[model samples]
Target: MPQWSEQTLASFERKAKETKVAVMVTGSIEAHGDHLPLGCDLILPTFLAERIAQKTKALVLPPIPFGESWPMDVFKGTVSLRAGTLLMVYHDVMKAVFRHGFRFILALNGHGLNTPLLRQAAEEATEGTDGTVIIVDWWSDLAKSVRAQVLESPEGHAGEDETSEVLAVRPDLVDMKVAKGARVRTAFRVVSASHREELLPRGVYGEPEGATAEKGKAIMKKAEEELLLLVEQLEQGKLPITEK
Candidate 1:
């Protein structure tokens, strides 16, 4: 499948009708750490979407690079969007894709804060219509078990898992020399605006120093397999939920 941004209008229309599915990657421009790039969120999901689309033949939409990151807004590179504004952006994009007769949309989210809003936007976009949207937070959702298998440290912003992934996709951008983090041991969730600063003073939450390209490749391979399975199911009319 072709990237939506690169497709000619005529080719896109023709291919979209044949494909009937699209994959959109969403993430945030935020502070990952001193070592990782601010665009870490976008890089991983965009990588996943491109890999999956190769097999599934789904059109890959351009990435949505800003998300709700108010918790990390204090960080220098963090660009946070208001909840409503992010929701509207997602809704509008999904609706536009659906309107073009591509009913199945796989929204691969990279930021945790964007998950609920993405869900809401997906629901609103497909309501009263035959369209269906599958929202996947690639790291938390697809790579959860893989993290346990391959990662030595707990997951957090720019942690072992994420650093490893970035290394696998773009090793040139990673700086392992200064990679560091504090082990975050949270009992439960709390609403503290200064959470990142207080708990993670270094702006990192896990052991990024332990990150390796091998672990990252392992995580990505599992994610790709699972996503391929999902796309297969959707193609077979076995997804998008059916009420009992």
Candidate 2:
């Protein structure tokens, strides 16, 4: 798993000739309750991209760290990119990746809100470059199949799912003593977003009480396998759109 940022110019050129696509992991800087790091959105995707690139032979580019973090910013220390700004950054990065001679670009996204903007960047790539780009909303795209495997009760901001993921990355970052679940008074969704703390005074939602590093490893394995298969097939000239 070579990091594009660390490779020499000549090394990059040589490696670019070896791979057909580059994988870009994108996430946001936002609060994830009191226990989880604001980087929870970014760290997991970066980890996945590094793992996936080993088998995919795709270059793992440095992750884009800012995303749509508004509303959540009320929690403090959260930074957000306006949707238009996010789109421009993604588009520019993809264009540069294409210019590097890769014909396929994979955006492995950890933050859900960035999906639409990433897709817009993909559309830009489709229309503006000779390369093809794919945006995978890492959790949402894989959750269906994985839920069957892990059997968690829906997702929350810094709940079991996210906490477990981070635990798998660094157990030291998690403080289970202070972790707690939320009280959902209704099934009704709100039209106007409330400050995150208003919803869960503890700054966390869902019961992270059950989270374990083992579950997190299983979840990540499932995602990495899917990503590896897709990249392998894409490079074999058997991209999804071309499959019979």
Candidate 3:
């Protein structure tokens, strides 16, 4: 299958007549934990995008590796773009894809902080173009299924779900020995707070211990299944597009 992008002129022309549903995966260069790599967010969605493309025969766009990472700004290697800038980036990408004749666009996002921003971007993209934008936060989409399969406390930055996923994808990157202890943060609304350091002193939340590669594999598998169903629904015009 062809990867989606306006840059690929030949492939775009070849798939021009085919169903024009493009999948763009977005992630970030941020700290996962002591055990997981900084690019964990990027890798997970990229992995999912590949699986989704294979299942739906949709063109996969290059994953965006930078996102809004203000909470993890203290951590080394955490790179973040402003939320406004990130939204503009998505808008431009969507416009380009729509210009290439794609009527359906999926924003397969991996980062948690980018959720609200992407939501806004997707709405804007849809309004600005004739193409439909479907936003999918893999973890959020399959959270219930993941919780049913993984027995660990699923609450950290590099917590159970994330660690398990990384272990499943790239075991060599995880330091099992360092993946100990739990860092629980007091729950507070970000809307009322100006200082993030007070809430997350260690740049993490939840328990990191109990993560396993098996659990990650199970979570990923469930995610793929859900995505396939979603794609089918979208193709059949069953998925509802709501405005915010």
Candidate 4:
């Protein structure tokens, strides 16, 4: 395993020199309805990180288990962080990794709200340096083709896609009997604390009843392939790959 915590000092130094790439995964403890656990965000990214590290030999940092969960804070089991706080944490972690001589930092974020902050943090951390930061919101950024094929319902918080992922990674934690879905209010971008509930009455955005572990596995497999390709591109100094 390419995990950071499990490595000895000498081993870490050697491996870090060889890879020059560090991956930090971020997630949140928030309400994912009654069927999914509060740690769904944390679990999914961590699962992907482990898979990526195993294949690419990239150093996987210990996951940041908190995120900006303001919209969902009205619900129980939701742990929210001030935007500034999460930003600083990400910036500091990237800075620390850079200090260790790793120039390529990959941030794998599981929560949707953390995307912008993660990008800002990366920008601030790598400014005026040779360091490169790659921010990936795994669910939305990777495996587009697979998602279109595997998911029938539109993507939403605690929806079909997420539910299937949970079932694939930790079936024991999912309560399929209580699984349900709700449509989000996209009429207007109303900013309110109650927006989460108003938009998703059931705390879910898509049909979880349609989720299957098989679909989750397919999604993850495709995501893993995409992630590994990105890392390979980084290794070959061919990063920032853009298509026309």
Q: lDDT winner among the candidates?
A: 4
Q: Write the per-residue lDDT of candidate 1 for residues 116-200, one digit (tens) a residue.
A: 9999998889999899999988988896788798888777889999999999999999999988776656678766875768765
Off by over 4 Å in 3: 5-8, 190-198, 240-244
Q: Which ten residues in a row have the lowest lDDT in candidate 2?
A: 183-192
TM-scores, one per candidate: 0.92, 0.90, 0.88, 0.96
TM-score of 2: 0.90
Worst 10 residues of 3 by lDDT: 191-200
Better of 1 and 3 by TM-score: 1
Name the 10 consecutive residues with the lowest summed lDDT in model 1. Answer: 194-203
Number of the top-ranking candidate, with TM-score as the measure: 4
Q: Model 2 segments beyond 4 Å from truth?
A: 183-196, 199-203, 241-244
Would you give me the overall lDDT of model 2? 0.80
For residues 115-164, write the lDDT of model 3, one tens digit per residue.
Answer: 88877877877785677888888776665656665756755577887888
- Report the lDDT of model 4 for residue 40: 93
Residue 108's lDDT within candidate 3 is: 89
Q: Note each model's CA RMSD in angstroms.
A: 2.2, 2.4, 3.1, 1.3
> Candidate 1, 146: how far from true, in Å?
3.0
